[model samples]
Target: MALATVGGCGSAEPSQQTETDDSAVVLPIIPAGTKADSILVDKSDRTLILYKGDEEIARYGNIRFGDTPEGHKRFEGDERTPEGRYTINGRNPGSRYHLSLRISYPNAADRAYAEARGKSPGGDIFIHGQPNGREGAPLASDWTDGCIALSNAEIQQIWETVPDGTEIYILP
Candidate 1:
């Protein structure tokens, strides 16, 4: 067996345990009953905004789109973000791209649109953290399978603030 230590000169023993006291840390807790009413994603500005009714809860810029990065996502492997109204239907804290909040893509309209063209309205869209474990990675490009990309830190804040079933509007 072998052990790899981070930032170690030679010896691999850790100086401190990897745990924190919630009570001791002055955490920025979300307000009680402060539920997010909607999420707005502006493709032009590359921004994602979280709102509680009329008031803005949190907003993040420098967002990334898909690899193709233009217009609505049509069929499977389009590599384009979708533009429509949807709900945050599912959550995955343990995901391949860090934490993820699943978007309910391929709604009735999308399915119909694709089906009419004899295509598959690809599913499994989400607002997720950056690649490489979603911990802390600088975003460099629009490269995804039609999923919105955010920094791991931004996703963490969103995970805490936005609850499932909240509405999301992705704009073109």
Candidate 2:
């Protein structure tokens, strides 16, 4: 039986590491017992913001996405990060990337839309860190197959703050 690799950032190719003179990336200090209830990703701005109720808790800039990085993903290999509301359903501590939070893509509407056209609605979207064993600065361009990418340090912060079942809204 042929096994299929589902939703990961898809490429084994190493993204070009960046060299910057900017100061080290600093994560915002969340107060003890604080947890994020929601996440928002703005594709046009390339940012991911975490929220606790109506208050903003953390924001990650320079977030990377699929090569196309323009619109909602409808089918497999579209190279587009999905837009709309999704839940963070799982966590991957042993991911190929540093750490990952799974996004529930292909909700019923997504599946119907794709199946209506006789195409598969790909699943397995995630918000994850830089690929494992990668060092230096994060990649300088959009690189993931469809999932969102963050720096290793940034992901560590997110991993701690975002629990499973958090609602995420990805906006184009």
Candidate 3:
């Protein structure tokens, strides 16, 4: 219900605008012509937001998640999306899913948590499009093994707008 609400936090701040000169405009956090410098996933709202500096550039709503999409993922097959910060580590254009953007899951804390419980912290988590067949793999709120699922067209736009190494903060 809160799809319009967006919060911004980043490691670096954009340069402040000044009356010095228009030519002194500082470069954006994203690359030239890119739309977003980073992304934020709000699991509770089932929404993913793209940000360029402190501004919310885009919002993708009605997202799908794991079968058991609450809490931090404890094992490889927990069917829960992980919470915390991650990066867009890789991209697969020809993925079984229409297209995929890999998110670095099982970070040190995640691994240590699973290790303490004697479980395998899952890997290969992604923000991906609907599958190539079957009329949408993640067609419901709880459908994936833990990855974020968006529509095919949505993923294509994300693929073009978001670059690898973009920080993606997934919130619980």
Best by the lDDT measure: 2
Cα lDDT tens digits, model 1, 53-154, are 888877788888888887998888788888999999877654555467878887999999999999988887888765543322455788777889876666
lDDT string, candidate 2, 28-94, tens digits = 8789778999999999999999999999999999999988899799998898899999999887776
**What overall lDDT, based on C-alpha atoms, would model 1 receive against the true structure?**
0.72
Task: Write the candidate numbers in order of decreasing TM-score.
Answer: 2, 1, 3
Best by TM-score: 2
lDDT (10s digit) by residue, model 3, range 83-172: 899898877654556567778887999899889988889787888766555342335556788889876666767878888899999999
Error of 1 at 2 (Å): 31
TM-score of model number 2: 0.88
Clashes of each: 0, 0, 0
Q: Is candidate 1 or candidate 3 better by TM-score?
A: 1
lDDT of each: 0.72, 0.82, 0.71
